[model samples]
Target: MMTGDAELSMFPADSRLFEDSFSAENTYRVSGQNITIHQYYCANLGVSASVWESALHLCQFFESLDLSGKRIIELGAGTGLVGIVAARLGAHVTITDLPLALAQIERNVACNTPLSGWPSGAPAVCPLSWGRDLHRFSSAWEFVLGADIVYTPETFPLLVDTLVHLCKDGAVVLLASPMRREHGAQDFYSRVLPEVFEVELVQRHPESNINIYKATLR
Candidate 1:
């Protein structure tokens, strides 16, 4: 129910689902199973509002890959969509966000729990913030996932550091982000990431202007 330039623009007003105050619920069918997510919008915390395009792309990326038995952790998980899908696909997943987003993530995780054929802890929910609280994890993770987490350039170092700390054993980090013309996020990812880890483009789509990158310690 929008009009004017919003309805005419090609960028998809769906991302704006996070920009205002509203509650959202959606069922995502992945790998023959459907996972439902609950999201609440807070004008003050826009990122937690709803699903983003990068998440859907990431879920598709996961569906095509082999993640069985992997100890996976998803950072910056908004509505826990990708992680929930991964869980349904049989990966041991822990979906995380900052403390403010935990309740929403926990709720979605509960909705998809005991992922059919998988064990009881198919998907767990947690609160994780970059740089300051890496100690909560006592072990290294095999796979790390992030969707649309590269917006702010100022936090690049902290985010990269967290990846480094989590994947000390050479685990791969999968990050999907839309190419932004402003904020220097693209530039930082190109320059800094290679200095610390080996980077590769897993997929790219000009239409959506999103790129999924797979990185590991060099």
Candidate 2:
């Protein structure tokens, strides 16, 4: 848990952060497999179109776990990197985000075909807006993942509601995000999340200012 007030740097919430003026595709090597992601920088899409450092850290953390045959669903799956990695590691993954973000995620999933020869099938891409259409999804997932999804305080309640809905069947939730103090990321982890679930800081990559949290229903 984070303590006392400290002069923290602000996490730029500007949409310009998503702009990659260089290449439309970024390649990442995860779990010994190379996953290429296609990203869009439409200002209307906000941060949902780009892959953040938290997603990369989550992928690194996933490398340490045996995700084979696990039923996983990822929320706010920007660019689908974490879910794609989980699928590559043999987990049955469903990667979801807002409706507009699905196209890029679908494209990435298609780009990484035959994920690790699992033969189970490719990841399913869907649209999920927090706190809405909760019944459209099942609560039987074995694992729920979110990377960099806590930066917006306005969505904190909805995100928590969605997590609670998804974890009703005892599914474990893994959330990874940079502690962006300016955006209340710390508060979401330290205060908001703990209010509903038993939260534990499983890993902290201090060099990258990212923390991976494991949570389950209280």
Candidate 3:
């Protein structure tokens, strides 16, 4: 329950879920896992529809892979859903997003898995901003993940830089995007990423119109 104007204004009508509407309690089932998360807008902090779907699609993709003992990091983790799924699937996942999304991410992290429920290799949340310093994070991760994180053309370079910096040598980077034209994000992957990563479309969810790419360090 919140009363502040900031919090009240955060929940926009366009994104609101009514209690009685079908799927009002938004949730997605991760493929190959016996887990379904009750996803929702970070009511205290806005989220776009693309981000929500992308997160679910990415989580399902990860669940379908062999990630028994991998080190994973997720960038722009809006609600930390993908990272949470990764953790449940046995990867050591670190979730990072802009500071504005941190509080909701932390709350979601707590709700999904409390301290006592911190499994052997559960996920953890941290602050990471694209185009900014990442010195706070430890050495590179074996796999970097993101979903619908490419919003503006201006942030494209920074996202690429962050991905390159976090990807360990020979490690893989997985990202999902609902193809936005003119954003130049797809171009960055086509022209720029090849210099540092061998990229390929590993999976695509046509139903959701989301494209998932797997990039390995070159």
Q: In terms of TM-score, which candidate is stronger, 1 or 3?
A: 1
Candidate 1 stretches greater than 4 Å from native:
1-20, 114-117
lDDT of 2 by residue, 116-211 (tens): 564556899998877776889999899999999888786788789999999999999999989989989889988999998999999999898999
* lDDT ranking from best candidate downward: 2, 1, 3
lDDT at position 75, candidate 1: 89
Task: Record all residue pairs in model 2 with backbone atoms less than 3 Å apart, i.e. clashing.
Answer: none
lDDT of 1 by residue, 64-180 (tens): 787777788898897888888887777888888766677888788777775255552557788776776688864467889998888777667768888888888767999999989
Clashing pairs in 3: none
Candidate 3 on 121-180: residue-level lDDT in tens?
557778776646566776557888888776566556667777777775556889888776
Q: All models: lDDT?
A: 0.77, 0.83, 0.67
| Alpha-carbon deviation at 191 in model 3, angstroms | 2.3
Two-way lDDT contest, 1 vs 2, winner: 2
